[model samples]
Target: MIEIAVSALLGAVLGTWPMYQHDPARTGRTSPSLVYTNQPNVVWKTYIPGSPSVPIAGADSSVYVVTQGGYLHKIHAQTGTLIWSFPIGGACWGIPALNPQEDTVYCTWAYDKKRWWQGHVYSVRSSSGSQNWEIILPGGGSWTGNHLAVDQTGVLYVVDCSNPDGMVNAINPDGTFKWSVPVPDVGGEEDLFALSVDEARAHLITGGWNSERRVICLSTSDGSHLWSVWTGSATGISACVDPSSGTVYHPGSDGILRAISSDGNPIWSANLSVVSTPALSRDGSMIYCPGSNAFYAVNSTDGSVAWSKPIGSSSSPAVDGNGNVIVPSSDGHLYLLSGSSGNTLWDVLVTANPLSHIACAGWEDRIWIFVTANDTVYGLSALPVEAKENLPEGFGVEFKSAGKSIYLFMPNDAQVSLAIYDAPGRLVQRLYDGVLSSGGHTFNPTLEAKGVYMAVLRYQGGMKSLKVIR
Candidate 1:
């Protein structure tokens, strides 16, 4: 039996990243079997004026993004060409959350420069950028780093701020209100964290950054109050939730990182401040934080700084499957740092303005990490490391992750069985069980669960598997 893995890291489904930072957990992790520490190759780029939010992928790795100019643009991630644009009705600074079922993407925006104070969240077709529906937010607005998020259940979580009080609203797939929980004791002005969930426990989390510095948790099932904690006196951006343990790693307003237990008690606090949010490694043992002039890797358990490398940016860090950190910096450079030693692998200037938004997509062997800076979107790809084994001769899987699709092929038309299984080895779906043709064949299997999975292909001779993280 031969073992196989794609891009090493897994998370974010087959490819269309519907969530803000790679899914409901907001883990900021990517599966790229190989990414160079040295400057990566810029596969493609396009100019999208008016400060585009980080791009989300649609079918076939096509890109969907909302611009501050009040337009939703769909561009091909591979060629960087414009597909279509839909009027969003206002300026947008928040990332768009995708509801793949309805072919819709959700975004919050204000008609003018007043920010989200006069905000509304609308759904647009990921295919044509056509408006599906709009919902006027109860409160004024929510800001950049901590925006709306969607869980695997297809429920959208958004923070509506009327500050010093705010409401966390959960919306159904049809855009109907499910439940809204209020975050009280918000003294005054507030910048809340992005909505994230510990899906296993049905917990939804958000927090305030300003005068109302608190991390609030609510039940996803009924909007019941779970727990709320004082985040800090300082301002912060986002929180990383570990669903398995129900732990939350919050970088509060003051920039210090704190670990809170599932029961709402603080476990440990670390001296880490991030410009945007923290990126947890796949194993949950380390957190990658991007600070104003450097990046830090902290031990998740004891709050110890494992390593720090210089990089100026106020954006979230992304960890590839290989455990390499990709940092898009305001210093006008995209840096690659070793997640372990914090050694500089490579850096390249992409924009003169702040590179604050980053996203990832894939097409076969090329996995592109994208970032927006100076009204431009840059797509980067790394070279394959020497250690990875090539696919079995005449048999392979072409992963079009951005589309949640896979292409499998064999040298000869042979009896092959391909199925999708969760990490626990339970069958999710039986994609095919017959003689497969030699040419690459496409299979579209909808993933319902949010966790690590494997798309295993077997024949009478042997078995091969590829990791599929949604």
Candidate 2:
């Protein structure tokens, strides 16, 4: 009797071995793919004066936008309702950085008057249209661009305009000066147009507008100088630091992307053939940058070409949670590309000219994208579930069993297995196990009863299930 019991236990273990030995390379289910090949679903478009150069920030389903018209407008991200608007003294030409912890946003703007440059920094409350703090810089030169950086502690870093002797100032959360660090005079106008922070190293990276193309790594803790590296020319828009690798991606006016190590050494560089700005991916795996006629994606690890698709002249690209890339092009349309393969997912035409700076925000189930041509703002429903998955890849699957053969065809490589059950859920048979590459797969179903069977295919990054008719 003991021998029989031991044999039964052994059989049980063997019978469920396939399930226990299931392949660990299963892929998660991804939403369907979509390409916006139609006119924009235009949520709302507003008008602004002059070419705008600022990004929109969203908090709690509300989007806050600043425009060159000296207007700060708060709108509903879903319905584009005008919640509130604040008018500043100068043209708002920079992206607004939000500090949700303090319920405030920091923005910068500049105005010109008879050879003088005037700039101001404003801290506005997120709850109500109220000003928390506002500071105006001295009349040295005009602030041509926006360079704002905020730390985790809510300290603001900003660079003053065209003044050769201008410096970067740090403001506390309450709008008090923490410290000010003067940028060493570069002989010409000090055009510190862009800046980034390295939280781990406690350093800040600032670039654009110097006699020589260079990036200054400043000590964030004490506002002291750590190091600076010269690239070539200061023509790029922003600099991004890869925390995992401690490398800086700087796009220069010379139309080249240079990778500088944490120690200020050159790692690799690539030319995009056109002046453009660089934007890093959330996962740090890819870098999307605008080229002359096409936007390009480079593998962040080794700076290799991943993919490039035509989109006309464009600005920095924004990536969404579902890996959709949105970029505003001179063609008067916003192009959305698949993050994985650089495939054109969608395009929404707004105006004849789109703003160089497009602000994008993503939330629970929606995405908000803003364009600043004629002050037009659009809030598009995140593409529908079916629209998101309209990839060229095969979609549906069917399973069948006749005589003694089971057949299947899946889009990608998957671990194909069979589970059999009767009307009462009694265990029957598992026809096959292991991985199945792309295309059709077949297995012998000799022991599979004609009642019912379920075939499941699991692949890296996705999975699919099919019901088999026997």
Candidate 3:
């Protein structure tokens, strides 16, 4: 096993490039995949038509994003090409839900006319940019809540806040009504919170305060209230349900993180100033939550603090396949930390004020990072470990070790620094720190310790390292 792992690592260093392959016809992903890695293969990026500020939704190898201009775009996941786009003729607030089984995509749209707000739900075919059916929702007010949840059978549950008659409705794949239930506190000013479907439990979960229960679980089949529980005074915090463990984790508005059983029983509550939805590890071991100016890694089993690191104001963190947690901060850097110890592995500067959550896809060594800045969408790939010394027609450095001496090649006259560290990141020697001419240089630092070491070349906004045996 040890030999196999080492062989794999060496193979990665030799640039075993994974092919760019994906099937957009695959079923929609209800949640992110368990496979994520530091190896980001940024395939492509394209500017969307309108402002797509919300998180992008995916299913069947296609990404669906609705712009505030009410235009729904179907994009190819692999190539970032616009497969098709359709105008909604109103405003789109949140993400769209895709139903692969029905070959349909569902979204909410609203428009104001003559002092009355009109809301409509549209179902479009996923394969072609064709409208299937449109259903007018029951709401006279102007604001349509950005809540849309779907089940396995293509049944969609949506929320409509229309004055004193707020409602939750169940719509079938054919745009016919299944049922409708009244929502509490219809005329209040609270945000319409999130809606999630627990398919295994056959329940719809959401948070509220004006209702009989703070947290309510309704029947997904008929929009009937199943059971409700109030965790605390906090409202509008979304709940994430773990099917395998049958546990729901949600953040409280009053600086509390509460874990509840599927049966509405409290499992554990931790008082942390959580601000975003918690992300669960693929193995259900740890939960990563973002707080104000910090990110916390908590044990999923007992809500205990595993590790915490101070980042700038950040969006929700994401877990990659290699157990590395990804946190995008307001400081224009995306921080990748070791999942086990919360140690910083690499932090790459992306764009300024990246408050939107990063979307990750693919498996194993080919994971891709999809991020949207203020107006542009960026596709970022993980840095390859292989040594490709072809220096892109600019200032660069290459490190080579032969016998007891180290050979360094600099492309231009630039300031450079060399350092040696052990396998565990302990500094062993500080060799040189000064300007070197654009030529080859040699340094023979005595190896006082008998272990594996790394030689680093730092110069001009870039750095490269090579592993050496002493």
Candidate 4:
């Protein structure tokens, strides 16, 4: 018999959200095999200069954040410490992608040269923030938002709108071109081109500003035009490719969530008021969508509406393996919705004023939800989505483990008492008992014996407890 701890089982697969919305397919969830158990805490909110993009989680749990100023920063995920920073170029940029096999990061930066935007993609070493190689984007285009993607084979797919045309360029790992396909009705100075690649089916999907073909499927191998489809929506949209079935779930501007096969066939369209990319479940059983003033969870099989909650509209949401939806709303609140009931289990205010650019990534038991506001990056957490599911609203409690101490966090000020009790209900030690202020507080109390203990926290709103296995 294999005696594996829950923590060990949770980390069976490396929990790395190395790109925006989790992966190149924009699924916005961690590995389908992972199950998170750590109590999500307000780990750390570090400030970085320039307009920061949503960070990518490296396989080692280190976060890589690139700013619009063309600077790359490596942050310690658990402590939110700035490990290193590398400047690419002082120009606007987009979310970066990670090539896991090569331990390399691919990011795009754009600069206006004589009123024309010239773009360059750089390959940086993930560990030391050193440049491996870089190549100028052909025809001079700007890459922004979710326009960048990388597959398992280290092939980079990016949308390049060079003046009068929008073309998807495939770049090899060695700073060479594989192929570039022209996407009609998508060429613009600043068009929103959503690029996603499904490696299993060898399909690459692109959508943006093209009423003629709202979605185009291409070959991931050699950039062949496989198929294209026109959804009713005219504006740009993104498609979430399901790894299990190669089903493409696209949320269009027409407020409909449509499921299309990789072969460019429409499976079904469900009107759920969704306008962002859908976050498919780990099991591919549900599609979570962020709509206007509400969040929708639809049954994946028949497009039946499972449940909906009025959580307000949000940036495209990211889900954990447990299906807990992490929504960074336009109102500057990052919410975690229950997978089953579509209810708000936890929420945090990332900023006061949202210029409307927010995204999140999940890694292991701890999920990293970040918002880039006012040229600064703010990263936050989820309170044990699986372990502490019954935590009430408003009075949320989060905790973290430092070197030799466990830090208890309070979302707001409250009269709190936290103590450690042995497995037999004997009081071991009192860590803290006072008016706890907002933010994290150290609890390095004398915990002599180690087996199973309970950290009970009593506060004004209510009492919450955590099981601690020392």
Best by TM-score: 1
List the lowest-lDDT window of 10 residues for candidate 2: 17-26
TM-score of model number 2: 0.68
Report lDDT per candidate: 0.67, 0.56, 0.60, 0.66
Model 2 residue 169 CA deviation in Å: 1.9
lDDT of 1 by residue, 238-293 (tens): 57786556788877656678888888999998766666668877677888887776
Regions of candidate 4 where Cα sits further than 4 Å from its true position: 1-14, 32-39, 140-145, 200-213, 353-368, 381-470
Expressed as tens digits, the lDDT of each residue in 297-409 for candidate 4 is: 89988899899877666467776645677676767777768877787776667667552333444443345555666666666665434333454322457654555566677
Put down candidate 3 lDDT per residue, 1-470, tens digits, no spaces: 00101122221111111100010101111122223333354467678756774444343445667788888887765567789988888878766766524568788887777657767888988779799998888756635556466654567777775666567777888888888777665333243445555553333333345543356666665667766667644455455556456577777777688887778788899987887667666567888888876788899889999999887543556665345777777676777788889998877777665646565543222335666667556666543232234542123455666557777888788898787754223356878899989889888766665544456556664554554554
Candidate 4 lDDT at 117 equals 73
lDDT of 2: 0.56
Against the true structure, candidate 4 reaches a TM-score of 0.72
Q: What TM-score would each prediction reach against the true structure?
A: 0.78, 0.68, 0.68, 0.72
lDDT of 2 by residue, 1-470 (tens): 00101122111100100000000000000111212222246776544444433445533456666777787777766676778888877777676766533578778777668756677888888768799988875435647346566654567777665456546677789888877766655422355556666553333334445454577777776778777887767653566666556777777777777888888888888887544555555456787778877788888877788998877664666554355667778778877778779877777767776545555543322334555555466555453232234441224443444335556666666665554432111234566667766777676644333332233333343323333334
Ranking of candidates on lDDT, top first? 1, 4, 3, 2
How many backbone clashes can be found in candidate 2? 27
